[model samples]
Target: MSMKSTVPSAQPDQFVHDHLPPPEQWPELRFDRPELEMPAQVNAVQALFQRAQQAGHAGRPLLRSDERTLSYAQAQSEVNRIANVLTVDLGLVPGNRVLLRGGNSVAMALAWLATVQAGLVAVATMPLLRAKELAAIIAKAQPAAALCDVKLQDELKAALAADAATAGLKLLVFNTGGAEVPHSLEKMAARQCEHSTPCPTAATDIALLAFTSGTTGTPKAAVHTHRDVLAACETWPRHVLRATPDDIVMGSPPLAFTFGLGGLLVFPMWAGASVYFPSIPYTPEAMVQLIGRVGATICYTAPTFYRQMAAFAQQHGIGKLRISVSAGEGLPDATRQLWKQATGLEMLDGIGATEMFHIFISSPPESVRRGAIGRVVPGYEARVVGEDGQELPRGQVGKLAVIGPTGCKYLDEPRQTQYVKAGWNYPGDAFSQDADGYFFYQARTDDMIITAGYNVAGPEVEAALLQHPAVAECGVVGRPDDERGQVVLAYVVLKPGEAAGAPLVKALQDHVKQTLAPYKYPRDVVFVSQLPRTETGKLQRFALRQQAMQTPSRNPTT
Candidate 1:
């Protein structure tokens, strides 16, 4: 079928238009609830800002750090001011993509809100991403401007310098601390009015372009609309998180991740609650300390971090924490039990993906189940289906398919065909539905590994490992471990002069850590003279996994 141009005026970036999958391939979208049905000219930012008008929250804190706090009114004013700069000063029209690079901070949150408020699509990149990864995203998204924290500008600058396509990119730096940076968001917004009107964007207009690492060792942009963002707030936070106006939220996941974006920024704001981003990245110990110090009532993080913080919270009382949310990976029963034992609070486990935007299958604390990953949340329908796309029996294991207000919409990639089939989004996870309708995770149908709740594609790790001078050839796979659920294991055939010893293993591991996110580095390495391969020269990852299973490992705890 030929591509039909829809909403051309709203998508000036031809890349977005050219990459959108055919309408038939899109997952079924529903706005069944009256609250879920947004008006035609709905701006999610304006809707979120309205929460400040709720009684008793006008002067209440909305964003807090150790150094300072911004009240609901103040944060909305800042968001408006930044939006003014983006639209009035920078001429960023609705539909233009603005790349955002920064760690989790108040400034970063403001920039994201401002980008969407101005009707521009936000493309947030992880701070740990290097130039090569940044370059790939730039090439795919073709963002016209970037808002970055000054501290995290080096790699983005290198990426822009290296890519000719981005040479003319508009670079705006934030969090400059009164420094005289030319294109600083602080400086730019200072000259703009603090009460700019929100853009009259349609509810279906694209709002964000979240890039996720794909199984093919490249990044794919997941497009989300204004309605989708609002729908996420309506379902998860309203139904599951159930935060109140008085709740104070804190978490470790970076805002660049969708999990963090929803948990730390969107959900709290949706409830007229406040969010606290630690001045610096918090260690599990520091996270526990901050929660107590700030009187945080709700917390969001992965299972591994919760495990590490459980003992710490017990040692120094968890203060006012009433809820602990876990996602990003499966929450181990042991971790859940340990946390419950320590905090006297049950951990809420949910499963969501970059495709779905946020958790669609989760249980409230009242409906807690021991090992199951909860029933499908309200506003979504999920089913386990066989290879032929037929729904399986309650106790059968098959691909997990779901339909919700938001679903997989990959930007200009053929992988969309694999992810969306018959109008159902396949999250690449294998699962089974019990008689009670609870979903039990089996394993990933793809090669992606979830270690410490971070998704690491094995091929991406292999690519990083092969870049090392000492590695002649390599195959990366996930080996089940007691602590992290799974740890990255690499089978390597070194160069002629390299020795197969502990130092070489350490060197290869360190090289991967330097090349990719620290969590993606191979935790265990085994030297091999050759890698199993097919006649076509494709590396046989199955054989490597088989070998890894046969070898005994010293399951090191993180």
Candidate 2:
């Protein structure tokens, strides 16, 4: 395929396309495989639903929960009705943006699907975001309308009030938990026709604007096309995950996050599998219990989530559960061993980015290595490169560079050059590949901690700390030190019924020394009720670093 923009964009609203980086900034996209092929004119919802029906899976359950279950056919009707509400009632046009704010629920999923079906770009946001964060996203994406969960409308209302630009933006609420509200999406959708047609969108038309989680700094919107997401759906999930229609998927990552968007919705829809969203928020213990009670087969969450659930899994049953996916952050060997010992299942660890959309490196349980994050998915090319962008020899740690069907294209940000250079995407992670091509995660490039003369990775120390029974979860970072430049600081969340004090802190430091090099042990330890994390379940290390820099380090052993 040519790298040129051969197909015309069907979008009328040019805001997103206008804001996109130049063609030169795009990482080269390839759809070389047979499965990756699709027609030039593609609506994501239409493509997915058509694929499922072709597979003879349209009649099966596609959405599941205790309150309601919607099969593919039923969900299609609802999506049509919602699409009509967006286009007809709300007068939204193709390429207009719809801001979505909700928890992971059926109504939230329907809004996202309908937004794309109408050829309008969907900007799904985390449910926990406050008015300030929502205001930032609204300022960036400049959505024309917002579909908010009834329970979460307060913050969205505040954001709309806070931002003068959004004063004219219409707001509609749904998933009222049965509030009998008027002018809600459900009420309007109920009056609309259930046979609305899919909008004619070119495959190259922008489908959505996914903002970075901003672990490094200010959030940047990553532009993804209908073709880009469809291409991704073809690679990893079709080849590696291979979810069956009978499989029921569940997870904790918010739908706003790309990881959750793929794991909970897009990938499952591609396979015609069912998704089970807890009506209430999921706690580790509650999630473990619900997995068995609902008979879910596939689970998607981060390693920290799995670590918290392992203890509950021992007390509860994980009925019919098959695949457990770990992403959003680095997976520690200690956490992997604990999960395996408890459930007798080898976790499917993967590495993906918000920029690329989803996982590109992962393997089946049978092929999973002891410490690596599996080989790169077929249909993609990956290599470890030095700072100079030259490929590094195997077993040498360097920046990870990859190119595939989907790559990075930031919205109006100078960081576009930082992400894509010379047709390859740099995810800014440190990794080393083996002779067999297995990729091992080291840490985020900025996550490396330098103290005295030796360099250390925070995840390595966090991994070592997780080996201790008292440590439930932890995030490690570097704290400023006058003599050594910086010292290792670990913020820990202890297990239930465990106490935190000077003795326990020294014990954790000693354990890390035993597990890794003595110099890598955390010089400072802070016990928190819970570590700060993004809605996607990624540790908010930047937050921890801020706290560490503001306060003095505690070295009980010294």
Using Cα atoms with residue i matched to residue i, what is each candidate's TM-score against the true structure? 0.81, 0.97
Q: What does candidate 1's lDDT look like per residue over 1-558, in tens digits?
A: 111113323545545655688877887787776667666667888888875585667798889987679998898899989999888888877888999999889999999999998889899988888998889898888898999999999999999999877877889999998998888999989888889888777777788988764333455789988878998999978888899988999997778778889999998988999999888777888989889899999999877578679879899989999999998766656667879999999998998988999999999888988878899988888999999999998998788999877889988888998899988899988788999999987656666677888877776677677667787667778888788888899888887888788777778778888988889988888888987753212356667777888766632323
Q: Score residue 365 of candidate 1 by CA lDDT.
A: 86
Model 1: per-residue Cα lDDT at residue 144? 86
RMSD of 1: 10.0
User: What is the overall TM-score of model 2 with all chains considered together?
Assistant: 0.97
Span of 10 residues, lowest total lDDT, candidate 1 = 1-10
Backbone clash pairs in model 1 (N, Cα, C under 3 Å; residues 3+ apart or in different chains), count: 1
Q: What would the per-residue lDDT of candidate 2 be over residues 74-177, giving only the tens digit for each residue?
A: 99999999999999998999999999999999999999999999999999988888999989999989999999999899999998998777888989999876
List the pairs of residues colliding in candidate 2.
Answer: none
Please give the TM-score that candidate 1 achieves against the real structure.
Answer: 0.81
